[model samples]
Target: MSGSGLSSLAAAMESAVQDAPGVRVQTDVLIRAATAIDHSGPGSPDWRARVAGAIEELVAAGLVECPRTKAGWDRRTLPELPHWVRRSAPPVAAPRMTAKPWHHLLHWVPTVDSERRLSSAERGLLDAVNRWLPAADQVPVVPMRERSWGLLGDDKALEKLRSGRLFVPGRLTLELLRCRSTWPPVQQRVLGAGTWLIVENWSTFESLCTAAEADGFDGRIIFGSGNQVGTRLAALADKGDTPASPVLYFGDIDVGGIRAARLAVTTAQGAGWPAIRPCRPLYELALASPHRLRVQPASADTVSWTTAWIAGELGQQVAMCLTRGEAVRQEAVGLEILGPAPFAALVADV
Candidate 1:
């Protein structure tokens, strides 16, 4: 066969394989396609020999594979063709290279973009960081949202800084960003006290505050404002004026409440403070109360941890309550249930 004829036959086979549903093409289909080419007439006896030669060339070049059987080619006679041929592995493209704006941010660049270029939002963030880093020392401490709004024109831009999505430089610390946690409202009964009590619900907080104001409770009383306690627990460390205390948490006896308490414990420990523990007396009071609300069943881990935290009969009861998809809100144990000197009485017991 002429060089152009051989090339045409090979091209036909390639097109047949490409047009097929999958990588593999039947040997007869490829041969039929090659025979259809202008160089090889369908009625010609030597067309199979030409097709077989072209297929061998493609197989030798690694353009296709014959997994079932190898072709045995002979110039004198028609070559043996395999049952099927499959397209070979495609070449892998090299990673796109782009110039980095800062050497320090080499690892921080996102790889999602095909062009290896920063998006408009990312560029804006980098620009803000550049402006802030040069004069970071000169600026006074500000709220995170305030700083975020001023720099990125979006108050929530820096919300994910600690979430690992954004790569902030080691030098550009949260302290420098001044992203302080919003400390919950507190009612202090004792001056320079180390022990503190945190209540979750608003009504419960008000009840606790009333108790604290009446000298019914020692130490300080804080309003956790629900699950926000987990994130804001770090503020206890930020407020240097306050003494490190054994923080006690009281909240709803539900999945969210338990998770929040767990989160607060982890966050407090991470901040070098003592682990937050449950306000046992308050929880027991709430559990025993007639008031009960339907709640989603908690996971085994949550139930197990709640049992472990409370311990013994009370723990088992709490676990059973959780299993039954029932919860006792902290509001159930209000001033009426707790009495005016509830914390003082509990303190005496301790």
Candidate 2:
């Protein structure tokens, strides 16, 4: 009612205590809260002046001891706790992690002594290192090699790459970009290249690239596996104000792939590039004949089950084959649809 009777310090201190990692009851926090309460609250305007007089009149002083625990940062307690601003939270419990250790969320590190700012590279490297550790309630420092200006930390940049960037120690360039291990840095194109094709999965991209080369259609190939297709769309579409080039997307025939293709076209169009419609002959390939469908195991947590379930106990696998219309894994068969090289020179057109 009356300002929650809480001065800024007491209210904030209690909150920090609840959110702190592992556990905490820092004695310093208590001292500060007590001091603030005595000096500023209730009948104490010139409270500091009255402190010396009140101390002489106080009783049972030495009996109270600060609380201590092994759970978190140093906290203070007493034999008989005071009205204890009674933090609206409960005590933190340690994790009983097994092979998969359950770690806290924050990974906090105290700033009392080592007050320093983290470099971009250093922060990236720390995040990379943390992947090896458990969760924490506090933020911790991780060591890494020189950071990269090339490795921008914005969400948009990472989205474009479809991978998380992290700093690593003993590295020459900035941190490494994450991607499917099979993926290679897009380099020069091959000779028998056919028309350019962009796909959402690397395995599929590889299969198609190889398949096209086999047929003497050497052209540029790209993996748009991570959904966010900013760069590929740029190459296919013109820059803002320029004409967009034609680019074809080859993805699954299912609704998800359709969504991804639609997004690519829209993004390209918005950027003033020529937004090409994606082509997945594979969808037609599967639907042209129902017998070719292949069934796969179902996991309840995924959407694969919703559209794929068939009748009988064999429903999961059977439905999977029909709903999406076959695995058609990139490795399974993308070359036949891609055909031979005819458009190999586009990569150099600029």
Give the per-residue lDDT digits (tens) of candidate 2, residues 1-350: 02544444444444445544534344445545546645543354323222211211111122112223224212131111222222223324432212322223213321211344443434443444345334322423321211111234343433332222221232212123322111224422344334556676776667666655665664566676546554555443322223325656656544455446656665665554544543434333333443443444222112222222111223223234434445543333345544543324312222
Task: Candidate 2: list runs displaced more than 4 Å.
Answer: 1-154, 157-194, 231-244, 280-282, 289-332, 335-350
Give the clashing pairs for model 1: none
Question: What TM-score, computed on C-alpha atoms, does each candidate reach?
Answer: 0.52, 0.32
User: Whole-model lDDT, candidate 2?
Assistant: 0.38
What lDDT tens digits, residue by residue, belong to model 1 across residues 48-105? 4455556766775677976542242221222334567889887555444355554343
lDDT of prediction 1: 0.65
Off by over 4 Å in 1: 1-142, 146-170, 174-192, 241-243, 340-342, 345-350
